[model samples]
Target: MTTESIDTAAEIEAIHAVVAAVQKAQRAEDADAFLALFHPDAIWTTGGGKFLNGRDEISEFTRAVLPGATKDGYATYEPFFVRFIRPDVAAVKVRQQYFNHADELQSQGSPLYGMTKEDGRWLLTFCQNTPVVDH
Candidate 1:
């Protein structure tokens, strides 16, 4: 493999690490810690297409979502598409599959997240979670 390929792989891995850390913070219901995974001016959107811009809005959204998620039971974030747009930008597409204690996929949600490396750290700049709705 070429050096560029290796670096791309490593960068994608780093983005995964950021997602993992955010998941950890979410499971713990730690808003402060969760916010640490995002940029201060991060833009977030929900399945309903509601945008929460800036730190305050994002913080509130995290506070509301995390607790409910923890209560309903947290699902593992399985990353599907981990691709690099450029050396400094990357995106991760993850599936949040709701599971029971035995790990069954009760329901599922897909979240597309865009991240950027700034000052030697990878942080989420944008994210949108779209849950699969059943009628």
Candidate 2:
């Protein structure tokens, strides 16, 4: 493989790891772990349409909701696509599914996460969680 291909592979792997951390944090209800994956100036918009600006706001929102968000059901985030805009920036499309304790499907979400590589670490810089609605 060429150097470019190798670099791309490594970058994709790093981004995937970041996405996996999100799933792990959410599933385990580890607010601190979840928040640590984001940049200090990150922005997040919930599936319900609430806009959270910056890490402070994200931290507050996540800490308040995440712990109980999965009490009845657990959430899983799977990245289906990753587009690199620059060597240090990437846009990742994720499919999020919620399952009840019995493993029944609860809801689905399509979230787009913008991540940036800083100090060799990939951190989420922006995210928009959109609910999948069926008419």
Q: Residue-wise lDDT of candidate 1 within 5-124, one digit each (tens)? A: 447777877888887887788778888998888888889898778899987898887787777666756667877797777667777899777777666678888898888889989988
Error of 1 at 14 (Å): 0.7
Question: What lDDT does model 1 reach?
Answer: 0.81
Candidate 1 residue pairs in backbone clash: none
Candidate 1 stretches greater than 4 Å from native: 1-6
**Model 2 segments beyond 4 Å from truth?**
1-6
Worst 10 residues of 1 by lDDT: 1-10
- Using TM-score as the measure, the top candidate is 2
Candidate 2 residue-wise lDDT, 8-64, digit = tens = 888888898998999999988899999999999999999889999999999999988
